[model samples]
Target: MLYPNSSSFTPTPFTLNGIPGLEALHAWLSLPFCSMYVIAMVGNCGLMYLICREEALHQPMYFFLSVLSSTDLVLCSCTVPRMLFLFWFNLREIDFSTCLIQMFFVHTFTVMESEVLMLMALDRYVAICYPLRYSTILTNPVIVKAGLVTFLRGAVLVIPFTFLTKRLPFCQSHVIPHTYCDHMSVAKISCGNIKINTIYGLTVAILIGGFDIFCISASYTAILRAVMSLSSAEAQYKAFSTCTAHISAIVVSYVPAFFTIFTHRFGGHTIPHHVHIIIANVYLLLPPTVNPIIYGVKTKQIREVVVRLLGGKRGY
Candidate 1:
């Protein structure tokens, strides 16, 4: 029989430990976290500003990038401020409903980020491989439809996470050991059966992540083939150059994420909780901080526009 008090337990206001054993170091740690959040905010918001203000940037690639910037802004905003509050002010109490809301937005935006990245890859594929049809294929209407689909897909997939976490009775403890609420972390605290939670989480991860990865890989392969077919070295170089920033963004976003997922699920007693938390935090913060820089430095058009603005030139 389960513990006698399991069914009656109520986890109303969950306490977040904010890195558990490192409570004393929370102050020092918040410095870097704060810096990252600041950089992410400025970087993503600046990118959005540039994309919006410059008519030359009103292309499909930049449109996707603007969506990406917006997503990053939301994704990091969902957790970073709360994390800062907990670290700096020791405000650790988050009610159950708020926790679920955070989880929903975090996971939903993560899926949306993945879908957006995949769309970006598709955009590159068409731009490089089917240059002639690129304009006709990805029109304004199609781009808008794609954005809507990406949002709905992510929201629909992640909505179940709230339901799954809500129904479970968290009899073990109301204290979450990580910085922010996530599906697995929240579910793991429950004393009730969590098989359904685990199964659904894994299924969603595999179905969405697996499929997106496959599409990105396939798109890149075809892009490589098309680039290689180009007779001029300059043409091939230019085509490949356009993809470098996207590839870098993809690596930064996905690599640490998969590492954290595997380590959390399978590392067991071998992995330190703090290590898992740190990796999780890095994966969340790094992409937002890095993506804009990569695009700004690599994409000559954006770089030129930035120069023109700084140099006080008009008629951009």
Candidate 2:
């Protein structure tokens, strides 16, 4: 394939390869992905609805959980529908503009979700470590401000890489070997220099992920120290219980993401391309699908409300 000159190249519609090596299994794959998507939608939406309706859940922690669910809704919706389309109907051709749009939301909301998880961790830290000041520190105004900051941080940081990717001339080929248009996949298919794109993507990812991890770590460390100092075993157990759901949330959110990152960067030919693609999809869907289940099972208030609603009971 002789390459066209970058200077005169015209952009073309990108073809998304959904599970490259498993094309024959695309229909079968759609079943699981579709099921996960439905679960994420129902779970996140139901969680948000429950939080809004139940007076007992009108706390700082539940407020953050609502935000987390909302973010998860957007994060999963941004990619899964189109992925399913490609799987079920084999609609792989995506326009340049649409691809860019998908790339933007996919990344922006991913950052937002990470920030929300970090916020949830911080909320737990305050509730356990500084119970008296929890309300004062996490007021409505403060929560709103934090939400604005996270939204802005994601938009501002992500715009540069998206723009950088856009400027690259795709003379090599427009076939993106993944289910969705991500920064690296799109950039790699371009004929132009992607050094800046690669660097900016890595730098932003590291800074954002590193800072969130640092804050979560610091918050948990302080929380552990405080819990250990409580002389009563019952008190210690009660304090630790509040964090179980949050700790689970963090693990599900980051573990698959890091695994996908490592496999992309280091797996080379040792890892199958389809495996990488599946992991990437799982990274997006797992948190949203599991979050409501985790909180519903772990949080007494949510569980009770769910039971009452299902059993047609009147009072709280």
Candidate 3:
């Protein structure tokens, strides 16, 4: 509900439309969605296992990867099951509070993951720019603190927006067009003026996602400078090589997300709502699905551990 004047008709329960204008293709669409979901779960779980099992992998970088995997697991889980149900069975009735809860989780994990990426940039910064002090700087206690702080930031930022939907009384429509309950989609149904919510939500997104991008860029800049200062080109190449996976992970994570959000807001009525929904889901799904693959192929330590794990299982 989102208007200055409430409509005579009240929303009974919100419905998730599950990608507007794509009803006929739901069954076919489910194949790819389910495949990606399984891959995300298996890949992230496998990474988590490798990180936890290999004592040598117990470092600040892997610690951040652990957080990322956990966050991605939760992130995809928040939306995928419900989306599959919608695509397969067409069961879309979600109570108002349930919708709010979903929105909260989807947004919370998004911010949490964003913050973790920012922390990772910091990790690389310290490892490269201050190699001598890397261990001391990102020691166990400090790593734990970084994680706690990331969690607190996401919780504090997102918990309030969960209630923002409560302020809107939806007399217009209860059907959300996206695969999941999203803040703006939920607000758009309200008959009330949602400028405040819009502005505040935008502010929070920028503060979290935007700030992270800026800091990450700065950290990498310093890292490049540090790498360049190395005496030999081989040393410099190795140093830069170590950051390649992280840089790839960061780009994949943030760029599409930013593009999706931007197109959603500025693309105007010319773009179809279905396009918006797809982009939104892509933003949420792509990073988690892609991250482990990137690391598995790019990070030598993780690659070796996974190969060993698979080889040992083959032996059995």
Q: Top TM-score: which candidate number?
A: 1
Question: Which is better, 1 or 3, measured by TM-score?
Answer: 1
CA-RMSD of model 1? 2.0
How many clashes in each structure? 0, 0, 10
Residue 192 displacement in candidate 2 (angstroms): 1.6
What tens-digit string does per-residue lDDT give for candidate 1 at 167-280? Answer: 788776999989999888888888888899988988898899899999999999999999999999999999999999999999999998888777766785898888899889
Candidate 3: where are CA atoms >4 Å away? 1-10
Model 2, backbone clash pairs (residues 3+ apart or across chains), number: 0
User: Lowest-lDDT window of 10 residues in candidate 2?
Assistant: 1-10
Q: Model 1, residue 45: what's the lDDT?
A: 96
Model 3, 3-60: lDDT tens digits are: 4534344476778888788889989988988898899999999899889989999999
RMSD of each: 2.0, 2.3, 2.0
Q: In candidate 3, which residue pairs get closer than 3 Å at backbone N, Cα or C atoms, i.e. clash?
A: 1-168, 1-169, 1-170, 1-190, 2-190, 2-191, 2-192, 3-191, 3-192, 4-192
Question: Distance from true position, residue 162, model 1, in Å?
Answer: 0.6
Cα lDDT for residue 93, candidate 2: 95
Q: Report lDDT (Cα) of residue 82, candidate 1.
A: 96
| TM-score against truth, every candidate | 0.96, 0.95, 0.95
Selected candidate, larger lDDT, 1 vs 3? 1
1-316, model 2: which lDDT tens digit per residue?
4545553563667899888889999999999989999999999999999999999999999999999999999999989999999988889999888988999998999999889989988999989988999889999999999888988989888888768877777875879999998878788888777788877877877888899999999999999999999999999999999899999999999999878766765685898888889999999999999999999998888999999898886553
